[model samples]
Target: MDELDLKYALEAILFASGESVALQALARAIEKTPSETRELLRELMEDYDRGMRGLRIMQMENRYQMLTRNEYFPYIRNIVKATPASSLSQAALETLSIVAYRQPVTRADIEYIRGVQSSSSLDLLVDRGFVRIAGKLDAPGRPVTYETTPEFLKLMDITSISEMPKFEEFSGGIQLRLEEQPEENGQQ
Candidate 1:
């Protein structure tokens, strides 16, 4: 297709996709080689900039998503139906991180790391899309286990759970120290 046709095609795909679309996926959908698709996308992005449009194509991780310029968010928020404000608390985030990195884990296991009862926090994470019930463990009670969802990967901008950073990568923080604080003080 010609340049204008290619621009329209790219814009349609980007706007239609609610989630970030990988370049490979975009190329396949448009029947173009990856290099050709990349060139077309770059041109389209430049056109948006040159025209001073409020929307832009953004690369996050290995995929692309269309986003309105930050300066325009206030105006857009006024006109559009607002998405519900959803956020995980610090406690919920910690529980999510543990389950995300150590998938197919049990509640008791999560409580061990957190050093506190985590049933409520786990319920909250499950209520959100971040965590999911994986299966029953093979041990005694056959308790249910949990794992991170693709939604979790999308939120974290990661392609896979394996890409999550190792716990040692986070070991030096005050947060990490706090995990073992009760243990060090001879408390359960």
Candidate 2:
């Protein structure tokens, strides 16, 4: 709406994009010409620089992105970097099995399948660098879906997820036993 509003909006958009956005595309999104958008970006860059902010905007070739400053990388790395988990607990293993097999599945679905709350197990899988939040479902509430990361593939010594044993192998045995039960409700 106003120039101040536009500036704030651009800041939020750049942060959310998490990747470079072309100047032309950003202008179109904000209903401004390329030149106008470029000027606004410069002003924003200067503002961040003047304040010595830990996060700054960078122009990567023809696009722009907001990222943590190089000076702070050491701290960020200290916080973010970690050794991958060497051993998985039983719950974590179970959670990983579900994610690997029913990939892009949600926390709710995982809990339902396992018949218990599994927040901690899921947390361990994520912190251990095995599973990741793939994306959100389009349905209401936008539940986060999960999938195995490349690290998991490499650790499991597999080239692709499809190479894993069939999901039916994990589920079919249960179904068979249930179906094998004799009918008694109507007395045959």
Candidate 3:
């Protein structure tokens, strides 16, 4: 299909689907190679961003979805059909932060660092779509490992995890003893 045709097809599919559309599915629908489809979709996404639209496309892993721009979230929330979501608890936020930084980590690993039973907090993060099971570790338990999703990056207002503030800098204040924390907590 031509570029304009492909763009319209994508727009129609995304808006009508009301969900993330897989890259492979989009490629098949457009009768294009996956790479070409990706490029076109990326261009489309950029166009939406640059066009001053109230909506934009978000790529999550290998799928894309149409999403309202962050600037419109408050207004959207004001008109939503359900009760507003409660804010994340401190423990949930802590667990999410740990997973975002020490990604592919296990519940055991998180509990070890946090010194608490983090099952509920971890579950809350996963249920909220901020965290997901990445893979199993090559350890004794072969534990299910966890990682932050693209949604997490989007909510954090960063394109990549590298843009997040150093985890050590944020947590070192508590990680170290008073004497060590003052001089050598996160300087490195």
Candidate 4:
């Protein structure tokens, strides 16, 4: 391979190695044959050793990982900024549950089910990356539809929505009809 081609291949491998670099993904990214990429990587690893760089390429569990030479982690962490994480409220949790169960539902539908306006709660869900606007529904008037994101699955620790708790069987106390209340015709 030429110098430019090899440089691009090396850069792609390094960037992908930040996470695990699978051979197929690296091949697709580099648009080259997997065998050639593997050879290039071996050469790069050898060059890295001969240059005395503080980084190394490693193969583990059928994936490649590019990491600092272990002696440099403390220096790296000290230079990075740290921020405190925030917690979600009970209201947000309930709203999230409703969205998770009834998506791709609209914001109005969520409000109707919760018996309250949910603009703020919808904003919170979107901000936290759990819910996303799937697209507008194709009904009489188009209303934005929302669905739980893959991030939601990750946060909830589930591989799929089928694993969610069954809410269909829970009957009654949830549906309080307005008309069922006793008539208040000036009765004490």
Candidate 5:
């Protein structure tokens, strides 16, 4: 097909899927090389941006998705009557952070890092589709391992976990203080 036809084909595929399409899959669909297809996709993205269209194409790693621009969320929400998703609690957010950085981690590891049980927080993250069971570790009891999902990446507005800020960048500013407790025996 010609250039315009190829662009339309890519656009249609992205719109119909309503999800991220892999670069290889898109290339196969358009019968073009991966590099050529990537170039075409970039041009289409630019066209949308230049036209000030309500829709935008986002590239997440090797995949591409067509989505309504964030600026138009109010209008889309009004038409869809969508309810606002509940925000994650501090505990859940902490659990999610652990899973994101040390993925394929187990509940035991998460609890150890947080210094508390993380069952509820982990469950909440699983329910929200931000985290998933990757598999089980081959240790003694074969504990289940957890990993962050693509939905988590989308929520974070990041294409890859590598984009996350380095731990050292923020760790330097945080300080932890523990209070001493009185002994129950009352033996001065």
Candidate 6:
């Protein structure tokens, strides 16, 4: 297909899916090599960004998704009569941070780090699609492990976990000291 046709085909796929489209899938659909498809996606993304358009394309890892720019959310919400998105609570945010950084982590590990029970916060994160059960740990009893989802990346406006700010960059004021807890046998 011609360049313009290829671009329009990609745009149509993105708009119709309304979800992240894998690079490979896009390439297959457009009958182009992955590199060529990536270049095309880059061009499309730049076109959207350079223009005063309400829509934007987000690249998450090897996937691309078309979405409305955050700046237009207020107007869209007004028109759609959608309730304002709720902000995460401090506990939930902390829980999410822990999961994002230390996944696949278990509930015990999270509670140990926060020095507080995090069941409710974890549940809320799961319910909101920000966190998911990656698998069960290999330790005794096989505790379920959690990890951040693509939705988490989307909320953070990041393409991948590697794009997250280095922990040391923001760790100066934070200190975590693990205290020994007595076991059921009363041994610490």
Point out the higher-scoring one by TM-score: 1 or 5.
Answer: 5
| Global CA lDDT computed for model 4 | 0.68
Candidate 6 C-alpha lDDT tens digits along 111-160: 99999999999999999999999999999999999988878879989888
- Least well predicted 10-residue stretch by lDDT in candidate 6: 179-188
Better by lDDT, candidate 6 or 2: 6
Candidate 6 stretches with Cα past 4 Å from truth are 173-188
Q: For model 5, where is the 10-residue window of minimal lDDT? A: 179-188
Q: Which residue pairs clash in candidate 1?
A: none
Model 1 stretches astray by more than 4 angstroms? 1-11, 17-75, 78-84, 173-188
TM-score for all predictions?
0.58, 0.47, 0.77, 0.50, 0.81, 0.86
Q: How far is candidate 4 from the true structure (C-alpha RMSD, Å)?
A: 13.3
Find the candidate with the highest TM-score and give its number: 6
CA lDDT for candidate 6 = 0.87
Q: Which pairs of residues collide in candidate 2?
A: none
Clashes of each: 0, 0, 0, 0, 0, 0
Task: State the lDDT of candidate 4 residue by residue for 1-188, as single tens digits.
Answer: 68557745766667665755766667677777878777777777676668667876665323455656655666666887633347777777878877777777888888887898888988998998888998998986899988787567655644456666655334336664666542222111
TM-score of 6: 0.86
List of clashing residue pairs for candidate 4: none
- Shift in Å, residue 156, candidate 5: 1.3
Distance from true location, Cα of 22 in model 1, Å: 9.0
As for lDDT, the candidate ahead, 3 or 4, is 3
Which candidate model has the greater lDDT, 1 or 3? 3
Q: What's the lDDT for candidate 1?
A: 0.76
Alpha carbon lDDT of each predicted model: 0.76, 0.78, 0.80, 0.68, 0.85, 0.87
Best by lDDT: 6
Please provide, for model 5 over 68-175, each residue's C-alpha lDDT reduced to its tens digit, 9 standing for 90 to 100. 888888988988987778899999999998888778889999999899999999999999999999999999999999988778878877777677776545555655
